[model samples]
Target chain A: MTDEAVPSWEEVAHRYGRTIYNFAYRLTGHRDDALDLSQEVLLRVRKGLRSYQPGSFEGWLWRITRNAFIDETRRRKRRPTVPLPDDDRSPLGVAPGADEALAAMRLDDDIQAALLALPIEFREAVVLCDVVGLTYDEIAAAAGVPVGTVRSRIHRGRSMMRARLS
Target chain B: MTHPGDLLSALLDGELTPEEIGAVSEHLDMCAACRAELEATAAARTALRSLPVLDPPPGLLPGTAPVPRRRMLRPVWGWVAAGAAALALSMGLVLGTAAGPAPMNLDGFSEQHTARILVQPGVQAVRAVVEAP
Candidate 1:
């Protein structure tokens, strides 16, 4: 009934699909779980779009993504799987003659590990901000928290990761 | 001088208001400790952002242009057709088997034909003649 412009499901999938996948990947740290959550979110988006009022589409989509992730997490009856710390074989965490690509890959693994180690709340806030690139207000809307809380969580989340990485 | 605390992160993210940005900027200019904290926070934020944006498994989202038209359409109707064909084949086998003669129960012919004998001996005799094998 609303006259506001709404994107078709195909548009949403094409435009935001990568972001949603990365968001879930950063949150869950498992590729399969991320894929599952993305599909679930897309399905929800398709269903919800029928009744969706024109508003912050990003927020609505992220909220559905986040909810689907949480539901899946709960249904699995276990915590998110944490990757093991980098092995000592490389000793320096990088091997001689390794290319920049390998070095970057190792660094990425460390960062992903740090992300997985964070508490779920802070992790969500940080991923939504840095990875998903949502504004504080949008993140607040999606998270059902205040802007101040979002700010604090992002700050604390970064501090924790910094300490862990250091 | 009071530190901006979490506002430093807000400033890094460009989330602060103009006035807040001004205040935080002023603090950053004067406060070496806060500057250090800001640098570390920015490092973490950069690392998070630098983690590669992974692509979803190909063809994960249906009707997305990245997928070829044929691949997407194939699985659906292909599955339906395969399933329907299997179902039809199985149904045909079942109907054909039912229509064809059942293995004759030679062990207990009298018991098997007892109902027929009591109901219609004449019909059983005709069937016996027609079904001799």
Candidate 2:
């Protein structure tokens, strides 16, 4: 492809690539796995953009990321591979409490680890809502569940995180 | 409001109705437990958002930008696609290797001769006759 056409893809990829990569990393807890998942999702996005419906581009892009992660999860199940690390490599940050930065950083790491401990479904919902900042309806669309289900999952997911924090 | 536990989540999300919001606001005003829980959930959400977003490795996008629009094939259709391609390839190979070009004057022969002439040895004889003629 010409250099000119390359930017269009790069634009879309740049817009969502890190988001998908971080989402995948959060889900899989492995940078390499996240990279693979992000690449696959972006490749699918490249091919699937024509079929993408207008409105809710983030939701559409995230749904692709979710599917790629799920596919990788299933494949790993079929042929067991080396276990992924417990700690994720994503750059999760606090709201910048200057005096409390160190404590917040520890809490952030603890929470990130605890998040990975949740079941895949709950983890998926929480990540979509709290991390990806998707609304309930949008998450319902990406997750293929009722909005109420999304709400319930997020609530329960948060409760689980709280339990971990305590 | 009796308790802010259930309403606190929706309240944190700003999903509560105005009336529910008023009730939740009232409860948050008086109830410390619910207030703490609200802060906790909010904290969780914040921590999740703050969780570092790792920079991806270089060259993740190796190809030219998505210039072509192809049909979105569902993952379920992937094997069907591969199987279809395999079947097509198999058919092509069989047809390509097992058959030869049609004879120019095979119609003039009897059915037996036609059938015989289809075989490689008979095809040579037919070729000789055709060449001679």
Candidate 3:
């Protein structure tokens, strides 16, 4: 074992649970999918914590979250039951909206819709920087991309939304 | 003041160094383009932050374990378990056959061996060569 302390899964969950859930919800735009994604991230964290080097917990956790989202996206793509653009829609797409009650979340539907309009790559970068609140280098590290790429994505993502938001 | 251009973004996120911030700040004083972009990014960031953070449904976290899990057998394990059972049954049958007539096996073409088999049959004549030719 490394000299660094090992945080129990309970502790990690208690600490980052809301953050991870929010990240997934913001990324997927569907509460059920968000739940699934957060649970997946937590499960992965529990299992992979032994291998975690006790550094950059945020980076590691976010990486797992991103990867899980990618896998889910690919799985959905293989057998899409509905026409869902890469717009953070659920696997069943907009149909679930009919059954779902208006949630008590303070999320602005307009902003969430605007965010979903962005391309996935740029959206991930912007969300990591602004919503997920990672520093540029941390976002880059978590995304497994160069700092320069992170910079570019943030710039483009914000610019696109900026044009549309105004 | 020069054009901060895209550096407005880096400055908005506080990613800029002291010197870079100074430069961008000076540029933003006169550059309407940079100012507009900066305002937009800030607005988008604010809007995103305003999006609510919802608590995950119960048991999705660590301490609250979900009660119901699909206890179905995994396909690979199912195949392995089935294969093991089949192997065990086949081995049992083979061993059972081998052990069934083990006591009745003939050590040689002896009179005793022949009498044992002819007990339920018509009188069968059999003789063993007592003298070697």
Candidate 4:
């Protein structure tokens, strides 16, 4: 599409903001950081929309979000380390309170912890595959790696998570 | 028999080939170990799938405010062009200054007199020629 025909920033944000935020949150496990990263990703998307090809919007958004997260991680590494507390409350502050819901949240927390315990490469693969539900090919594209590498990372990551969960 | 754990995850993920599924089924029937592994992997996958979909924290939604497209590249390109212009100007000035004068050639300093002058040791004529004559 031509530059003038590109969608507005608001439209792009409305369509992809939530997905990018969730992907960031799954990677960082911190809500505040996720929010900031999501905004940053959206900002980049807005700036880059003119050049974006007419294709899979989800894949394009995913690629932007992944790069934004990686950049944030690098920036964070250079700053003084401040420990982030584990705050499990939902933003709405309304707990589902169902037995199944609570159990699922608990499992989610466990899985998140297990995922964090992995190397960054493995963690990224697991989050993209299991949490974000991207296909292996999509993950490969987002990560700029080969499909075989993505598959191996996902397989190794899942094995590690299974071991930890069990 | 193929280890059930090997196939169990693929089955749970719906990645099993038809042939692999048939083999896994046959193995599951005879091997209690394989069956248990499949059951555990299935349970874990279900638990994982049940996790709640969380809304992003407040103010993270795209509608809050449109991020102004920061025209970063324009300024960067401007600076690069300015630098190139400055470099070209500086090179022009340097060449202009360096174009001032060619060194004056000594008219009589031919190679034929050099060996005789050098062989006459302590000759003041050689010293005068050597001193930028």
Candidate 5:
């Protein structure tokens, strides 16, 4: 879409803010850090919009989001560690029939916990592949890796998750 | 028994070619181990899909008002201001030295004068004469 055709930042914020925020939160497991990371990602997306080619806006946005998270992780590594307090309030609380629905579909708390336990590389692969529903190629582009690497990582990651859950 | 670990992962990932799929299917008929692996992977992937799309904390969107550009620019301006002040002080030293006193070849005067020149603005203008043989 042309720059004009694209939704205004405010509109985009209104529409996709929660999605990006949740993605960051799940990736970071810290609300404050997730907020900061998501804001930074959006800021980069805004500045870099002109350069973004016309195609797969979601993919492009996700790439920016992924990079932003990686950069924040690196920055946090250099700084003194201040542990984020646990505030595990799921905005979408466990709903009625969720367990059964998830069972039929296969999503359970154990799976999520297993996912969280994977290494960052594996976790990211699983999140993008399974949770985000991105194609291997899209995940590779977003992750700045080869498609083969993405496939292998996703394979190994899923395998590890299965082992953990089992 | 077919090694379902390899084929199941490939199948789950949609990485298998049509021919590989046919081969896998044939193998699955004869191998209970491979069948079990396929079932497990399917169950796991299905479970993964059921994960609720988490809502990120408030205010994260592509078009959201950025950490105000002005806020980011503040540090840049501060650096510019500090640089400008340093330049002004240096210029003052050079100009002050040029406007004031002739240098004499005395030990204490040289040391004290050097210190005094450093403290004074516009002292650089006097540097040439002070160094002359």
Candidate 6:
């Protein structure tokens, strides 16, 4: 629309498309899911651009991306497709057994696997911070959480990743 | 102060308030455990950020990139149209069979069909009129 109101969808896509794709990929560890999620987010951004005001574009885009991701996750949950290895673990990290630990050591070498192994909330925070390069405040706004929560999640998530990757 | 456990990440992220940063800095100077924790946290941050940036497959946005097979699946409107056509065909067959062979009134059928088309060409319209006496 206007110079100040919102950038056109094409411009947004060109500028942020790769980042969004990578964000989804890191979160889900699947390229197809990433593509679907990216397209869905862009579709939403296109539809929402008209009503957008000129505040924080990063915050706005990421908020849409986060919500779309959650919706997609819920949709998948309802349909119950082939379950991924890391899908069923609780939000808190559970220690792997000796046999599972060896398997994890091998699997954790793949960064995406390690990332997928983190709980969703922690994974989202890490991806948003490191992949999307969002500030803590921006992540908090996008996630609809307090900044402290964002901070805690990122720290804990990265710690878990380090433990796995080590 | 305390361990400043999570504050280590906030500090590395440059997110700590000025006062928090100063306090954490002072704490780190005296605390080897916290310094090591900060380094571990920084390493984790580095590893996470080291992930390769992946480009969205072509055609993530229409007309912006080359179309990929996954995206080349029929558009939504195409599927809708095909579904509508199948429904109309099935309803037509049902109606024809239900009419039976009692001296086929081709003329009456044509007139009614034309009327249905004129009123509403959709399958739902056909069902509404067909279900009517």
Write the residue-wise lDDT of candidate 2 on A59-99 in tens digits: 66678878887888889899999865644322444355555
Candidates 1 onward: DockQ, in order: 0.30, 0.27, 0.28, 0.18, 0.26, 0.28
> Where in model 5 is the C-alpha error above 4 Å?
A1-7, A80-82, A94-109, B1-7, B13-15, B61-133
The residue-by-residue lDDT of candidate 5 on B26-106, one tens digit each, is 889898877877777777677777666666543354333335432212245655664675697778753446558645436
TM-score of chain A of 3: 0.80
lDDT of 3 by residue, A31-131 (tens): 77788888888889899987878776677778888888888888888978563344433322344356442341213666777787899888888888887
- Candidate 4 chain A has its poorest 10 consecutive residues by lDDT at A88-97
- Model 2, residue A148: C-alpha shift (Å): 1.4
Alpha-carbon runs more than 4 Å astray in model 1: A1-3, A78-98, B63-133
The true-versus-predicted C-alpha distance at residue B100 of model 3, in Å, is 92
Write one digit per residue (lDDT tens) for candidate 6, span B1-133.
9999989998888888899999999999999999988898898888777654555677885566565433323456755665675697778753445667447556544654565565565777779889998
As for lDDT, the candidate ahead, 2 or 5, is 2
lDDT tens digits, residue span B1-133, model 2: 5775655667788777899898889878888888888888887777777775576666665543444553333345644654675697678853433468444443323433434445668678889999994
Candidate 5 DockQ category? acceptable
lDDT of prediction 1: 0.81
lDDT of 6 at A113: 75
Best by DockQ: 1
Best by TM-score: 1
lDDT of 2 at A26: 78
Give the lDDT of residue B126 in candidate 2.
Answer: 81
Best by lDDT: 1
The 0-to-1 C-alpha lDDT of every candidate, in the order given, reads 0.81, 0.72, 0.73, 0.70, 0.70, 0.79
Q: What docking class should model 1 receive?
A: acceptable
Distance from true location, Cα of A104 in model 2, Å:
6.4
TM-score of chain A of each: 0.85, 0.80, 0.80, 0.84, 0.76, 0.80
Candidates ranked by DockQ: 1, 6, 3, 2, 5, 4
Task: Show where candidate 2 strays beyond 4 Å.
Answer: A1-8, A53-55, A84-107, B1-6, B29-32, B61-133
- Each candidate's B-chain TM-score, in sequence, is 0.45, 0.40, 0.44, 0.45, 0.43, 0.48
> Would you list the clashing residue pairs of candidate 1?
none
